[model samples]
Target: MSVNIPDKGRIFAKKSSFYPSSCVTEILLALLGIFVFIQLFYYLFVFSKLMRHDPPTAAYAGAPEGVSVLVCAWNELENLRELLPLLNAQEYPLFEIVVLDDRSQDGTEDFLKEHADQWRHVRFIRIDKEFPHITAKKYALTVGMKHARYPLALMTDADCRPIGTDWIASMVGQLGPDKEIVLGFSPYYKEKGLLNWFIRCETFYTAIQYLSLARAGWPYMGVGRNLMYRTRLFFEHKGFYQHKHILGGDDDLFMNQAATRTNTSINLDPESFVYSIPKTTWSDWLRQKRRHLSVGNYYQRGNKLRLGLLSGSHTGTWFVGIATLLWGLFSHDTLLLQILGAVFALRWLVQLIVLGGINSRLDRTVNWLSFIGMDIAFFIYYVGMSGLILSRKKKVLWR
Candidate 1:
């Protein structure tokens, strides 16, 4: 007697009975489902805030207030030379550029001294020594803020250049009567390299998180490169006093503590954007990222939980999704394969639409066609940097 056996196609046709039989495979499938759900939740709920946001093109309606642009520089003479003229030419009615020279052995001091008469709005404060009590960068910022001539303080890095003459006006205009903090976007100058693409993508994603959360009334962090706040707010918070011992977090950690939903506003105007020079080499970028990520441990418990969930789900979605898809392929389970394909397709679709909108708003550095590949690269980045992110030992350098 000969027994009859069903072919692969016939087995696949009976989808109901073709489910994974192995416990491990079933568990992975379940986890993939959960992660996909989380990803969708973030995309449809949290990130949608940014996607739906319509930036205003009109100038601010309220009366313009005097703004003191605060820049902290450490051996950045060359960058300052480029930045000062831009600051001096700001179209705002009343503003001053206060540069904090933090013990720069470079010709920054002489350059500022020589150019004092040339740049009408530029002023320099020299920091001869460091204070053991506070971190170097924070201490420098504190000194600069103390010496600011105006109540409104707009902070940008020495390496940053504003998009246009309206940078100060656009940023200060967002600070309505009630708001104390205004978060602005800063993108890296586009360069012809894979590293530059990743940097821009990473920056856009970071902005999406904090900016969207701010829009959603859970404001957490802001970048120093183009952040604005009242001088009173800084002094009230004691000026990075809580995390003074740590090297980084002049912007994020301070915002983490001081920024309330009602007090913080975001500036999305392209004219307000500040462009910063990116690290050209891999080692330089890695060190910069390490210093930045080291401050994540100091965020509030709720902020940490929210960010951890978003990032954790993002990482899981890629890893678990791939594993399940591979399992389905090896097992020749047509239903499982279809389910995985649908999950991935849904994620990519949502990412394309939402991130595509965001990319258009900022610099269009991320190629929508290659977004999934870039996302997978970020997943690898998260895994690779996990150790540094979770480290408790404080980074000691401020440069």
Candidate 2:
């Protein structure tokens, strides 16, 4: 029982060794809390809009309105061959498919000329030359819209095929008198590769944001693979004249500039979906994404802020969350570790529920169990794409 009085310095050191520095722990805890709050806000408040959405039944009171299906093709001869039959077979009346061939050297002209009589609803316009100032895709789209026969214009890529024959009717049914822009869903065909999974998940997440935000009266963008609007809206906005010099954004940039809460509508009908062929290689996919994201800088200030917060918080949720957990473990603080675990668990639980519902609603290919992995992937993707998105120097070509 030699209570040999230990030095005061030794006692202080022993206590300090039991836990990490208070300042570091407090700062990390505060950051973790904030990031968790932001993550929950998006899942609960923002994404939940899509989760809870109930698409109206496809209906029309009168003769099915005429719709001009715009397909812009450059080197999409095979795709057009596969897609034309489907477009001609759509279970809708008075819909025309206008294919604008943008100086294709790949026999697209020959193929269309050969089968022009077979595809009754399909029509093709060969663009012999390119506009020096305009991007290829935008120029083709502008020409297609100008030649659109119907008042309503439905756009899809040449590489995309509708899931069902009712695609036009389902999408057109959403356009009420007040709605001018109709945003439709487009998913990549299920292929056997990790790249395919990533592409599908990325598309799913993007659809969630744009479709959900559109429903929330903050419509920002739409995918060209499956999108629709009144031809009047395009001409009124000068048909991509604002950003014609920049590649990509033929769909999104136009939507960002034209879509409004009252005029925009979203069609989630599975039949309305158009499935496109995804990029098989990483380089091809990266180039495609670079073009897609190049227009982000031109988004409306409010839209940019909204998307930035959502993406920034998503990135912080992983980075700050992991850091906090590591610190808690290092400090040997059971309470801190337990709190961090609970926060992460809660966030993931919400994510699973919300995103799971979305997957089931849109593309059921991605397993809910893979959400944690995809969340981490998205974190990496956002961080990686931030620079490319910010840089206005990289020239993106739309082929």
Candidate 3:
């Protein structure tokens, strides 16, 4: 199917028969002008609206619901050993930690058996190899959910640890009365490197977009680390049936299909945050991102278009805006150059305001000087990013 966007006059100009070349030039310039304006409007209107959202602060009434922390692990012997003790030590009144050891060979089953067999609240399940051809991660997640004993099921990766002892409590607090899903922030622990900076900045931006949109009654997705939704909602939605064949959607695609504005809630309590271990190498980070990008093809059409517009206009802001400015300078068009310069400054100012606050909120440092440089470099960055999306051969393993 072809897309037919509604065209308005002056902005969407048509070429003339007699002066076709000149009309074409005018049309291109007008389109560039419209594109830059859209970029400015997006930062000012669409994304910057995130600044208005506040953290979930209502007192959680009554006794908080018991949570079944469902973790799916494959060869996460080290992580499980370190985090399980902390999970059990939560100060919350009622909760259980359930882990699925999916055919792990690195002594994961042995580690699981020692504690799960002895403790009442801690549980573990072993899944042996099967030939029926199923997405291993989704299957493991489903098994954990089926065996969950509490009303709410909280999911976190084996490599993740709660930000604080009250992590479970803070996440549970957001599900108050009618909220079925609680979307929480998950930030990677800061390390010393440029890659770490990029990872942190990306995480902060993603959180701002998802959290802000959720607050605006357009909830879309949540992170698996520190994510909670009712067990009933899981079974009701048939536990990843929507995109079960794909391995990575256990967190996002499920949210894309199941979340609705009224039923979903967000918890921005720093206490509710989950800290994930960032991949130390470029290859590792690429594989992790490929897993995420693979699921984009399956998002709902409207949501996909929303992202396309957001990225496209962002791209246009750099390439088209620069080209327009260069053309004005070459032609000695002072008025055109002046207008473009003002818009460029305005856009940069707004980005600094919005992104600076977001960085602070997520405990990340904001480099005021690097803001423009990074924004410009992202044009080249996205080209490689698009390639990662297309290279679906790299798998997202739970291990």
Which candidate, 1 or 2, would have the higher lDDT against the true structure? 2
Per-residue accuracy of model 1 over 1-399 as CA lDDT, tens digit each: 998887978778676455535665789888998888888898889887776687545355556678899899999999998999999999988899999999999999998898867988989899999888888889889998889989999999989999899999888777766789999999888888889988988988999999999988898899999999999999998888899998789999999989998999988888899999999999888888988887888899999988999889989988998888788888877888888888898899989998888788776756787688778888999998997666665444687
Alpha-carbon RMSD to native, per candidate:
4.7, 2.9, 8.1
Q: Write the per-residue lDDT of candidate 2 for residues 40-89, one digit (tens) a residue.
A: 88889988878678878888876877899998888988888889999999
What 10-residue stretch in candidate 2 is worst by lDDT?
388-397
Q: Count the backbone clashes (under 3 Å) in each candidate.
A: 0, 0, 0
Report how far residue 296 has shifted in candidate 2, in Å.
0.5
Question: lDDT score, residue 6, model 1?
Answer: 73
lDDT pick, better of 1 and 3 = 1
Candidate 2 regions exceeding 4 Å error are 1-20, 390-394
Cα displacement (angstroms), candidate 3, residue 391, comes to 4.9
Best by TM-score: 2
Model 2 per-residue lDDT at 294: 68
Give each model's whole-structure lDDT: 0.87, 0.88, 0.78
Q: Quote the lDDT for 209 in model 3.
A: 70
